[model samples]
Every structure is written in C-alpha cells, then in structure tokens.
Target: MPGKSGEIIDYIKNDLERDPQDIKTIVVTHHHFDHTGILDKLKKITGAKVAIHSADADYISGEKTQHGSLFMIPIVMFMKIIYRSRPVKADILLEDGDQIGDYRVIHTPGHTSGSICLYNPINKVLFVGDNLMYSNDKIEGPRVVHEPENYKKSIEKLRNLDMGVILTGHEQPITSGANNRLDTFLTELYD
Candidate 1:
C-alpha cells in the first residue's frame, strides 16, 4: 500500500474513500525503502504517529544504514532517487508482543531483524511483512533472508497462532482455511 507520499495521500482519500485526517498511526512492518518511502510525508499530511519495530527504527531515523542483501541495493537506490526516500523518525518503537490498536506485534525476523507481523486475535487476521508473502494462491518465504535460523524459528512460532486469514505484503489475502495451509507449509518446511 505504500507509494510515493502524494500517491498514498490520494489513495487514502480517493481509493479507500477515507479522509487522511482519520489516519491515526502509520505502522511500518519493516524499514524497506518501498515501505517507508512515504512515511515522512504521509505522517506530516495526516499528522499520524509513525511506529516501527525497535530493531529497524534506526534505519528509518538515519541513525543506521540497512545492511545485508545485494538485491536491496538497486531497489533502495531507485527509491531514493525517484521517490526521494529519506529517514523519518519513529514516534513509537515497537517491541514483540506490543499492542497497537487491535493487533499484537509478532517479531518475525530474518528478512530483516525488525520484520514483524501484526495479528488481530479476534479476527484471526495476520498482516505478515516480507517474511512471508502470498503468491500463486499460497504462502512463500521471502526472496531474501538475512538470518536463516531466525527465519525458521519465526515460521515455527507462527504455527502457535490460531489464524484464519493471512494478509501478506503482496498478492491477495488468504481468507479461508489459512491455518491449514500454513500448517501444511510448516510440515513441509520441517520435514
């Protein structure tokens, strides 16, 4: 959903049919340029508090550079050049298990140390970042991983949640029997 600053503002008002003023918080799942590109301007426009996981907060704040991944360099460079991506300070530095609105932050690292998924217990809906992507009507692991062990552990932990719907970073939402599909994937993963 992240795009150029003005594009996001326009999408919020036009496509989503919602006023920008109604946005209370800008929750970034990670510090990838594509995701955080609009954070600064969107926050200013909507006056929304920006939140990011503590592990990745420095990346967005310009306190630390994003390390690891050769594939990211070109994309990052492009975003910087075209979208004018820049660091934006985070108002809330989230930790694992932190609650934001109805969602609980689940720190799912590997793709990035600060990668997280927001889970709404009542709705059984999970918003997974690049750690897990929806593609071809199924869930697939991220294209790049920074920590393999941590990534496996993160996938293992997701099995504990009673999930019914999965809204990943890409593709359409998996709205039915997500738990079974995920468990199947986990079985294949461990086996």
Candidate 2:
C-alpha cells in the first residue's frame, strides 16, 4: 500500500473518478505492506468498509504482530517505516466461498496466514494475491518467503478454478490460458 497517497487518491477520484459515496468497500488480500500501503488513507478518503480475512484481521488491528524470519526483520522494519500501515479493524471477515458482490473469497494462505484470492465466476476473473506470481514466462509460487506447505495446498485448491484471466496482487496480468499456466506450475511443483 506504499505509494504517493495523492496519486492513488487521484486515480480513484479522477482517473476512475467514481463518486466516493459509490465506492463501498476496500478489499485487502493480505496484510503485507506492499498491498496495504495506502489502505488506511484510502479508506478514510472513500469511507469504504475495510474487508480482510479473519486470520489476519488482528495484524491490521494492531492486536497481533507480524513475525518474520531473521533475515526479513530488517526488510519488514523498513517496509513498516515506509508504508506505515495504520491499524484499522476489519469491517468484514471473509472465508472461503464467501461472496462479496461478484467476487468469492478463496482463503489461500501461504504468503501469509490470511492471504486470499477473489474469484468472479461470472467473469472468469481471478484476483490472486501473492499466492502465486509470474516470472520469466513461468507461473511460480510467491516470490516472497512463505509457508511452503500451505502455499502448495493453496495452489492445489486454486487449480480447480476455471479461470479465464488472473490478476495478481503485483506485476502483469495473465490474460489468456491462466488455468493452463496454473496447471503447469502445479505439475512442476508436485513433480
């Protein structure tokens, strides 16, 4: 969520330019700083209900601390300083198959205990938060350090989806044959 707050605000208010009153909810896929950089401010400006998976609700609420590996401590500290994720309570606690509007929440925990992906079956669009990533013409697990077993299980769970396109939390979108790519990643992962 760490970026120029003004740019994000302008993008939401001017680029998309939707009425603030019309924007109802801000969905967070995980508690990571990169994805939540401007969350606090964005919610303030849009007055949207903040939704997150229950497993990570405590992290954002400042009720629990995020513990990472020794090597990642400094990096996490730096991100905390840079992003300043202001603690906020979650308005909605999502679980697997929970529907919010057109999207269905998939609890894909690995990169974090509460990592999630939103799948819109009607549109065949999957909003996959860092559960997976695209790199070097290949779909792979999260680039960041994560819980390996949980990540694998999460991928296996997602492999069932008949997705047309995949929009990851970061980087380029997979616009064609996303399910195939996921299959390949799964096969490679299990092999």
Model 2, CA-based lDDT: 0.84
What lDDT would candidate 1 get against the real structure?
0.84
lDDT at position 30, candidate 2: 92
- For model 2, state the Cα shift of residue 116 in Å: 0.7
lDDT of 2 by residue, 48-155 (tens): 999999998988887886767688678866776767757788999988889999999999888999999999999999998888888777797877746776888887
Worst 10 residues of 2 by lDDT: 1-10
| TM-score of candidate 2 versus the correct structure, residues matched by position | 0.91
TM-score of each: 0.91, 0.91
Error of 1 at 91 (Å): 0.7
Q: Which of the numbered candidates is closest to the native, going by highest TM-score? A: 2
What clash pairs does model 2 have? 1-34, 1-36, 1-37, 1-38, 2-37
> What is the lDDT, from 0 to 100, of the residue 90 in candidate 2?
91
Residue runs of model 1 more than 4 Å from their true location after superposition: 1-3
